[model samples]
Target: MRLADKVILVTGSCTGIGKAIARRCVQEGARVVLHGLETEWGEAVREELGADKSVLVIADLQDEATPALLVRTALDTFGRLDAVVNNAAWVASSNIHTTTPAFFRQMLEVNTLSAFFLIQEALPHLKERRGAVLNIGSVNAWCGEPDLLAYSVSKGALMTLTRNLGDALFREEGVRVNQINPGWVLTEKEIQRKQEHGMPVNWYELLPPEYAPSRRILDPAEIAAAAIYWLADESGPVSGQVVELEQYPVIGRNPPKK
Candidate 1:
């Protein structure tokens, strides 16, 4: 058990990558604090993981007070904290001309500002424990996807935050900070996006014969595996780095030729 006896908090964990990370943490002998806005799904995850091993903290990360409340809840229930995975995000697909100001503000508030506040609130506890912080971001942070303007921008800021904080805390506190960038994942929302774009249900089946990149879209467990590695003692020396999760084109490589 790489994370034995650790206490981990994962935000937006009722589904998708967050839920997967929480499950992996529990499997590694860690007590998990699950945070999310989804009440029914959060409770269901709590039950699925066993009530004794996991507890749900209902929070709307978009709110100003949520970060402090999350830290307090974790400490109140778990006695100490070992790690935090800032995995919650908001996505609104819009080009610059098409995006409303409110939409842009809300996207930043959810994706970037919330992370800033959470890190501020979690700092003292993380400093005390010499814990790890993993910020979930999109690979588009570097690749520059024009269609996902606001989301890409927010994730780009997240990448910068990870590097800057990792440098700031490494020498004095021994805390590690890192980012995980997941590629096109097969989540429910992604499926909806494909449908909206007029792709068939079996889109993968329709790929051209020459498209030789991995046939599988990223799985939640695969992302969770990377999360576990980042949180584990093995990654203590690795900070200020963005580790990507997917099959091909690992980090800096371009997409497969069309």
Candidate 2:
């Protein structure tokens, strides 16, 4: 049991990567606080994980109060907090012309600011246990596609946040922080997203070699598997690091030969 007796909070956990992480955490012997915006999805996950081991928080991350509420729920329910996996984000497509100031602000509020506040709220408890923070970032943080300008900027800032706090907290307060930047992953929403773009139901079955060298995108479970190491004590004395979970190099790699 890598995370035996620990309590973890995972945002956006009613689905996708966050849900997978929460499930894995429970399987590894930890109780978890699951946060998301959908009531039905949240309840479904809570039911799946069982009320004995998991509780769901259904709220919008754009709300400033949500962070503190999440922390309070974890402590009030589980008695202590041991880890936080910030996995929620408002992912939308927009470039300069379409990105209004209000739009950009909302992006930051949901994707960047919420993570920061959640971490801040969880800090004191993490210090007591010398616990960890695992931020789920995206490979798009390193200069995303043209359509993802605001989202890229938000995640880029989050990467810096992870590094800065990862160092400061670990050195000053003994709370380790790290990040995982995952590439394209196949999640329920992604399937719907691709369908909205006119891809067929079986589109994921045959991905191009360029985007998926293994002929497929990643699985949330794969990302969840890697998450346990950072959250678990096995990663000892390390912080301020970001790992890119992609099949091949995201930077400086030549395009696949046509």
Candidate 3:
């Protein structure tokens, strides 16, 4: 039980990578506060994790008041806050020409600014516990495809926030901050997205070597496994580091295109 007795607040916990992480946290003996927009999905996870081990908060991070509400939920439900996983994001396809100011602001509000404020509101509690913050970034942060300008930029900002706060928080408050940039993971939404793009049934099974080095995309559980180390006491003073969780090196690499 690496995270035994810890209370973690995981945003976007109703689905995708956040759901996997929340389940893993419970498995590792941590009590978690799960937040999401959908009440049914949040209820499902709350039921799965049981009332004793988890609490569900149905909220939209777009609200200016949401960051504080999440923090309050953690403190009220769990009695303490030990860690936070910022995993919620707004992933959409929009190129430079298509991205309007309002759309860009919406993306930033959901993907970047909310995370910053959540950490800010949680700072006092995190400082008390010498806690940790884990930001879930995307490999697209570096340079995205033409159709992902706004989403990529938002993630890029999140990456920067992780690093900036990782250093400042570790030194000043003894709270560690770090991030994981995951490659393509086969989440429920992703599969549905592929189908929307006209991919046939079971489209991911035969991925080309260039994208999936081993002919398979990443799994959400894999990302969750990596998250445990950072949130656990085992990582030990490591801060301001961003790890790429892709199958291959993200920088200066040429895939076989097989």
Candidate 4:
């Protein structure tokens, strides 16, 4: 019960890493506001955690007004807010040449802009509680693969936002902000995406050794554990930090080619 009595708003909590984080928070004695596009999953989670411990909110982050509404709903339901985990994102493949203005804008709006507005709308409540904000970033922020150009750029901007807000909020309002850039994680969505991209049926078992040096990819629960640490006071007074969760060094080391 590390987060006993805390009230947390976790965006994209319907699935994947976000779901894991929301579950972990509830397990640690926190009341969670779960937001995402999947109404079914959200309702299931809400029931699983019980009505008193969780609230389900369905909102499209791409909408400009949704951020404020999400904050309002959480406050109305729980009467207070303690932490926020911005984890919803749209990950699509697009190189420089292939990325159109519309595509780029869509990516930024969903991946980065929504988080910015969410933090803005939740600022007052967060300040009142000296709360924390945790942005779920991607390892792609550091010059991602060519196929992920726009997505990478969006994540890079999110990283900057995390740093800038982490510093500013900590100094001005005692609100802590931090981020986690996760490497490849095997989620339901990721597996479906791989299949859509024409990967073999046994793709996980067939992954190149270089990419899967440990014979496995990260699990959503692993990322959740890290998020819990940052959102909880157990992390102390840390802020403006970006922890990259990956199997290999993200900087300078080149994996051996097959």
Candidate 5:
């Protein structure tokens, strides 16, 4: 049990990669605070993880005050807070032409600002415990597809935030901060989202090999597995790292090979 007796707070944990991270943390003996907008799914996860081991919190991160409230809730439920996984995000596909001020603001508020405030609110406790903060970023931060304009911008901002805070906090407060930029993970929400976008029920099975280098898209559990090392003490004082979790090299690659 790498995280034995740790108290971890994971946002957007009702489903997808967030849910998998929470589940994995619990399995590693960490008590968890699961936060999400989906009340039913959040409650279900609380039940599944067991009341004694986990608690559910429903929040809309867009609210400026929600981050503090979430941190307080986690502290109240458990005696202390050891780690926070900022996994909640808003992903709206919009290019420059389609992006309105309101939409852009909303995307930044949820995907970037929320994580900033959450870390701010949790800083005191994390510093006390010398704990870690794991931010779930996306490979799109490098340079997203045209369809993911706003999302890519938000993630890129998050990447910078991770680096800035990881260095500043570790040097000053002794709290470690790191981020993982995961590529194309096949989660429940993703499956449904793709379906709604007109992809067939068996779309994943039909994906070209080029789309998935290993003949399959990544899994939430695999991301969760990587998350554990960062969140746990075994990572040993490392910080300010933005790991790109993907099948292909993300940097210095041209369009493609003929």
Candidate 6:
């Protein structure tokens, strides 16, 4: 119960990483607010977590008013806000020629703009509690994921936003901010997409094993663990970092150190 009594707001919590993070926060004793576009699944999560403690805020993050509403609901329900997990994201696998203007806008709205607005609205409350903000970034921000160009670009902006906010907030308000760049994770959406497209998950064998050091998709819970750390006081002095959660190290030298 590292996060005991803390109030956390997690976006896109109906499934995947967001859902995993919300569950973990609840298990660790935090009062959580779960947001998602899916009404049924969001309500189910709220019930699963016990509606008395965990409320569901159903709203499209692309809407400008949703962020403020989420914050207000948290304060009204929990009396205060302590942490935020900006985990909502959207990605479309399309090459340059296939990508559309609307596609880019959707990606930026969900992956970047929503984060910006959430942070802006949550800042006043966060500053009051000296709370933390955990931005969900992606390794794709650094790696070339040409198929997900718009998503990659937006995630890059999110990474920079994390740094900029961390620096500014630390200096001015003493609030902690950090980012987690997770590697590929096998979620229900990925599984369904794979089945629908008849893509082979084992195709990774075609590439050198060293290219994908872990050799397996990351678990959402693993990523959630990292978020939990950032939300806790134990993460002291670790602000402004972009921590990558992958099976293998991406920072070490290409060849042997010797």
Give TM per candidate. Answer: 0.93, 0.98, 0.98, 0.97, 0.97, 0.91
Local distance difference test, candidate 6:
0.87
| Cα lDDT, all candidates | 0.86, 0.95, 0.94, 0.93, 0.93, 0.87
lDDT of 2 by residue, 3-118 (tens): 99999999999999999999999999999999998889989999999999999988898777888899999999999999999999877889988999999999999889999999
Mark the regions of model 2 whose C-alpha exceeds 4 Å error after superposition. Answer: none
What residue pairs are clashing in model 5? none
Clash number for each model: 0, 0, 0, 0, 0, 0
Candidate 3: TM-score?
A: 0.98
lDDT of 6 by residue, 1-258 (tens): 799999999998998999999999999999899998889999888888997669998899988899999999999998999998999888568768877999888888999999989988999899998999999988888754778788888899999999998999988887889999998787767666666677676543343455455556788998998788899999986778899887676655366333
What is the Cα-based lDDT of residue 106 in candidate 5? 92
Q: Model 5: which ten-residue window has the lowest total lDDT?
A: 249-258
Q: Estimate candidate 3's alpha-carbon lDDT, on a 0 to 1 scale.
A: 0.94
Mark the 10 consecutive residues where model 1 has the least summed lDDT. Answer: 204-213
Clashes of 3: 0
- Rate residue 205 of model 3 by lDDT: 97
Worst 10 residues of 2 by lDDT: 58-67
lDDT of 4 by residue, 92-210 (tens): 99997999999999999999999999999999999999999999999999899999999999999999999999999999999999999999998878999999999986797787768
Candidate 4 Cα deviation (angstroms), residue 141: 0.3
Candidate 4: regions farther than 4 A off:
none
Worst 10 residues of 3 by lDDT: 249-258
